[model samples]
Target: MPSPIAINPVSPSHSIFKKMSKSPTNLPASAASYLSAVSQADAHARARSLATTVTPTTTPPLSMSSSVTVFSDDNVLREGEPKMFDNDDGLSYPPIPPTSEQVFTTVHSEFGHCANEEYRFTSQHPPGKPVPHHKELDPPYYILLSTYISYMILICLGHLRDFFGKRLKPSAYTHLLPHNGYAPLNSDFDSFYTRRLKLRIDDCFSTPVTGVPGRTIICYDRETQDYNANLHTTGRRTRGLNISSYNYLGFAQARGGCADAVAEVISRYGVSCCGARLEGGSLDLHQTAERLIAQFVGQEDSIISSMGFATNSTIIPALVGKGCLIISDEFNHASIRFGVRLSGASVRTFKHNSMKSFENLLREVISQGQPKTHRPWKKILVIVEGLYSMEGSIVDLPKVLELKKKYKFFLFVDEAHSIGAMGAHGRGVAEYYGIDPRSIDILMGTFTKSFGAAGGYVAGKKNLMDHIRVRGHSGPYAEAMSPPVLTQVMASMASIMGVAPEPPKSANGTSSNTLIPYPGPAPAHMLPNWFDLPPSLKDGTEGLIRLRRLAFNARYLSRGLKKLGFITYGSDDSPIVPLMLFNPGKMCAFSRMMKQRATPIFTVVVAYPATPLVTSRVRFCLSAAHTKDDVDLILKACDEIGDWLDLKQGVGERWSLQEIMDRAVELVHMDID
Candidate 1:
């Protein structure tokens, strides 16, 4: 038998590949040569075949392959030449990065580990409705249109328009990916949708939502197979009780301060500033908005950006560079992961929300030092979220602050899903824990979810804001937050602050207030001295009433789901209610049944990439607008669906609130002394 081939484990800095950079002629005749199109597993099979083919002859010298070789047509582009290739192949290949020197590839150890479908997001499609195709005039439609115009000749001195919709709505096949797996050199394209229609998915995820995403709103039943795609829904004009939208505090309502501000700003600024923040896109409204958000969140200053995803992905690089370490929760959003990668900082992940894993990982990294170098890290940032959007779990802010104090590390928090929807004062995790917000070094959140606005904000000390303002990648390149969006956000903040004065009762043909104050000086801190209500806001009115109603609805939903024997994820205090179905097939069934029920329950069915493979879920966001009866209705329908599918496993054995609290407390104290 051939002697066992030995290859040392390689680091990114110096791989086993360097040793294989030998001439092709120098390799023994028995050496293996595999095609680049094949996966590492296939390559391994070929290697084994080659190993047995030689019958234990002297080992052949390994030779690296050249990626810069000529094409099949003998075409070769010189350096700096524009890329030219043929489309006749009809295959999309990973670009072979050109290099003069030979580049040897290695096999991955965990090649088939990703047999599960949760690895779907590695490809572009992920798990959702397909992106609509661009518009084009159909030839048949154009012919029919011309005939009508020519036959009648009743031209009304107006430009002709295409009545027929041209945007091709993708079917179920578009949502699927080819050759999905974990880390691998390549994939095997085995599964595909054949000409015969297999199982049909409704593909109505983008079914247009009209008016407010309140307790009840008008929704076009795209589930109707023959429904056409348009700005307005023509199918049945059905009203769905919405639990899917992330209008947590119910600020997205049409007759609110948020909507009013949007209208006023649109009339004044014409929608957009049409430039980057530095290029006059930012107005005084933007500055005022930032300052108000900072004060409300208890930060010295803050910076606002047009895109929420960019806030994390861009600011992280500005904060940390090489030689720094970023310890992040495994469940942190993809934006945070991308940010850490882009920052060039060494990243380590602990178990999701496990304080024990966190401290252990922190201890290990601090004791062992940086990878390869064993040198001390220049700075370390421990990043976490106030509330995980997927799991709906809350982070123990006090415990995290304690750990930060013990380790002397900076704490960066993403409150995107929590800020306006959490705490007694709607501040976030810090207030939820009754801990000072000042303990956190970097606070980032988005105005999109709870505030019903279209941007994100990063709040911290003045110096931190200044550093990001000058060095951050997000603001200089991307367009500034739209003026209307900024106004809406500012108005929302004031509503939370309770100084969004009640609009005068006037019969000016407007049910909603058109004019709103741009928010006055921070208004007093909401929880100053605890239970001390701000004078302007009565003890039980304005923002307080909304907060109370939302809290009650959250608890009602949580208890109801529990009673149904359906497993739910998230803290009792959180408005993000994720019902864990685990089975992907079940998730699809639950989603369809919920919508097609006697009373349609609109919800978000998240599978694979969003949650883990088996834990695919249908998440319901609570709103102040949801009544007790609404919660009961959802619980009843979900119970019926779960029972009909025989999904109840351990309803009677659900963990108690006290048990959860005790366990959390125990974990926090495990390594304290």
Candidate 2:
């Protein structure tokens, strides 16, 4: 036999060691053949049976060096390259290529492996073939399970720490000696008592008089019967004549047509829309309500929402977005302020009805000019209220209109208090001043105040109204305006129309010139001033005639209160009359005293935070519903309360008529009592 063939190693000893260290699963072909030769004949046969039945066409493994030789069962060993082994049959085998497992092991031994050593794969299988080298190939699943188990362990440890960390340690009291030198009590008993005593104790509790504690007319808990009982008491007692509510026109509790309209709404649709508008929540009543509002205000279109607050908060924001400026009156309603804030526009407040201030602000803006590269903030919105809710003063509409024209700003007026109270046909302050309704961009009002309903509407051009209906946050996001409730609005509008007097004709034979008084030096069709007279007779007329009657009623009430020695504040034109009381405690006491005398006077004790402490008062709201008898009864109650308290009139009252009127013209920094 030829001498055993000399076999040269494929690489340097260090390199071979490195490869072997990297992958322990890899074996030299020489070693494998030697093992195969040494195994029992039966074991060899079993191994052959487990091997792939289909013959694989051998291909060389990837390598950077081209000089390396690879050997298989069919290939003869090359001469230049040294082989590792030669079998009895003169066949030789080269070392087996390093497997992935061997490479990983080699790397781990020399340069520590990743913490997850078990995740490394040893072989790459062909498609559809089971992974042959490993017992399980889904190592990621096992890793995830391990991670979850570790997390749970950490969580449980944290919970244990939290539970024990909060526990209180025992103190010297636990070990205190008994008087007889024996154990004082059982250990469990002491522990229980200690735990109970450790609990935090609170001192504050609800007092007997916890609710509103003045007056016999209950503002809340409408079912409470003892009108003279303390409203603040913890018991089911109430006081005061609930007059703070928004029933300005007395339509809420009125008899006849107004009551019937409310009933009709209830009959058509149940209370509440059940869901916001834009869903299946809007009823036909909502449409009718909008129609009635549009007709009443002489607008092209209108959209109704659940509340006046919604009307403001939703509409302004929807109409004005980025690149817009909002010019608001200092005394504008909170709703208007909220709307402007939501609009994301630059806001500037003008002095209350100060045309000069508004002009100056506009001049500054115009002088600064706009940037050339960006779109200028050209869209300007001017917002004001027809009447100030707290001060009972009217906005200077003519001056505001002049500013609107000069700056080309859209005008939005809130008629919460003025609607259904002013104007020739009770159309609102705009109509009262003979302003063409079309000129006002947006008119907003609430049913809760005048119409005695629970909704509000925004009247404007048809396109703007349409945009608001769809884009308004309140209209689409909140509860839809009920349809049945809208029907009631229509009925109310019809009733108002029936009661409205037709305009008297003028000698000029034009319908436009018909009921206008104090027509300025302008055309006959021009709007009138406060004094009801044509240019020829600027002194007085039918308009003044009606105004004088209303003023007479107001002065009559004032005289009655004065005769009873009760000081009253507010102008003759304003229905709101406030009886002054500086002390909050006295306000409650006086209200209770008056109620006990069987006189139910509708009034509210304005207190701190709602009004200045110095201006605390009992506010009485006079209405069209009140008659002479009703006024007399209210005056009598005031006298009785005054006599009971022995209250003497102050020397100089801060709430005098002149002071109130002057303050009304000034910017309202805060709410008036």
Candidate 3:
């Protein structure tokens, strides 16, 4: 195995006992209080780290392989302090609250303040306008060559080190060797890729973060002495502008209407649901949430699962069997693939978001039928995501629906990233395209992305949902969604749908029940009688505001970067914007540079395996919590860093950094060919 790269050397000087850096002077009370509280917590954490320090001889836990998201002690508000931090950090807060409205009660760090209605935009696709396809931009020749060369160099160096390390340092190779007649746990390729290539840039991934991962996330400062085999917290924190987390509508918060409801539910029902759905775990909240979700997605019924991944992986098998076929998009999420693989159903993938490719493949499969026996398949399920996570592309739902009508395949649209982020009313790709959501056979989505909650849901006809509730793996085996999570989902979903007036009661003082139509308000009785949202949230004004702000930010950021001469991917309305970095070295450099800026900006970078090898890029997940100024800050950072890293090799109508920022609204509205 190749020796790991040394990122930061161990030293006593880096200890937490060292004097902390002074926070910015003249901060607002909320900002000062938050910073002060965070400092005290850091001191306590350092003391604990000292007590638990391990000796050099001890084997360190390899935490570098996974991303770490930790909630800090800061989540617990100090006594006498306001529950909401409207100005938790100086960067996110507005200079003056909107005078027309009542005092803003939101934590600015969680949801940014942008009072200008002009800053908002509806996310619906233009009528009669062609649905945009995924556009791939190529970099300059030398850039591509260097990217390939960088990988080649890394591979060659990794092999050379592995060859020598095995012979020279036999102790490290013990695990790989057949000792005591047991087979090695990991393959040679896995070990080499991990130790050599991955370790070098491990610092860029899975960074330990503390506090709410909203507009600004607080990352724990840590260093590794022995490459990335282990991480050591230095008892320091860096509050960076977070363009990394999947907080599309900016619902992820420690203090909000939704959070209050969640806290109340936790107090009432505790955390766990006690058991699986089929067991004694199901709650009235689950049924209510399912009803609201069904209404939200225009489905007759819905089923909730405790986990997002399991919702797909578990229910998929129940939907299909051995003789069934799953026609999937090439770039579908891993969870979808896992579910398809377990179903024992045949799968055929088309070029991602390419309607022509999908149509051709569908025709071929329909004609040829099953393999070997050449018998007609029992059923075919076509699966695609409403929005691609890595590529930031929106699936051409109109085209897919067109094909579905002709081929008669069951359509499944995964709206994990699209729900609560797309559409004029925040409904998903179907709504974005001005189509009925029920036109698709199945609509699967997760609360983790846009709802600021946990778990997933499957919505369709009442019979289909009833079948899934009974036959799905999650029903009998998996634990049910927690009470707090269920409450959060209900509160957030209700806030989006708005609470409708109670139906007229008869002389007996009892009202009849009725299902609320799609895009309509939730019936007032569906929510807990004690759960009362603020006027803004109850009326769905806040949700509408969030949706519009998210659309604007998404469009402005994606368009601004493209005009600044960087190769980018995805639709203009997509909150997920991917700026191509190409080379692996550049990926690390881009992330580090952005994070190290004056107003530090945290971003997610992707390379081979997660994305295509040569198209290594930084993905900026725009949020409704971000203000117009936040988008400008991101564009400025990217422009400066892109120029430094020689990344502006994209072919486009180039605009200077200032021009792009100045005319952002115009740029957002500009037609893209």
Write down the RMSD of all candidates, one decimal each. 31.2, 42.4, 10.3
lDDT of 1 by residue, 346-367 (tens): 9999988888899999999999
Which candidate number maximizes TM-score?
3
Best by lDDT: 3
Model 2 poorest ten-residue lDDT run: 198-207
Model 3: which residue pairs collide? 67-206
Q: Which ten residues in a row are the worst by lDDT in model 3? A: 57-66
Please say which candidate is ahead in TM-score: 1 or 2: 1
For residue 629, model 2's alpha carbon misses the true position, in angstroms, by 1.8
Ranking 1 against 3 by lDDT, winner: 3
Give me the runs in candidate 2 sitting further than 4 Å from their true place.
Answer: 1-243, 261-282, 354-356, 365-376, 499-571, 578-590, 593-596, 612-614, 636-673
For candidate 2, what is the TM-score? 0.51
| Candidate numbers, best lDDT first, in rank order | 3, 1, 2
Alpha carbon deviation, residue 209, candidate 2 (Å): 17
lDDT value, residue 107 of candidate 1: 13
* Candidate 2 per-residue C-alpha lDDT over 131-238 given as tens digits, one digit per residue, 9 for 90 to 100: 121111122343335435644664576445434544553243444334356775645344432222111110011112222111112322211122222122222222
Q: lDDT for every model?
A: 0.58, 0.48, 0.79
lDDT of the structure predicted as candidate 1: 0.58
Q: Of 2 and 3, which scores higher on TM-score?
A: 3
What is candidate 3's lDDT per residue for 1-673, written digit by digit as tens?
3335432222223221112233234333453354455455445444657555322211111111111122234443232232222233322222222222323456655677667677889999998988866569788789989989988998898788778988999788878777789998987787876777667788888888777888778777667767767877777666667899999988888877888889888777777765433324467777778878888999999999889999999999989989899999999999999999989999999998999999999999999999998899999999999999998899998888888889899999999999989998888888899998889999999999889888999999999988988888989999877889888888888877889978999899998678777778888877777888878799999999899989999999988988888889888889999999999889888887776665667889888878878988999999988888888889888898988999888785899989987888788877778
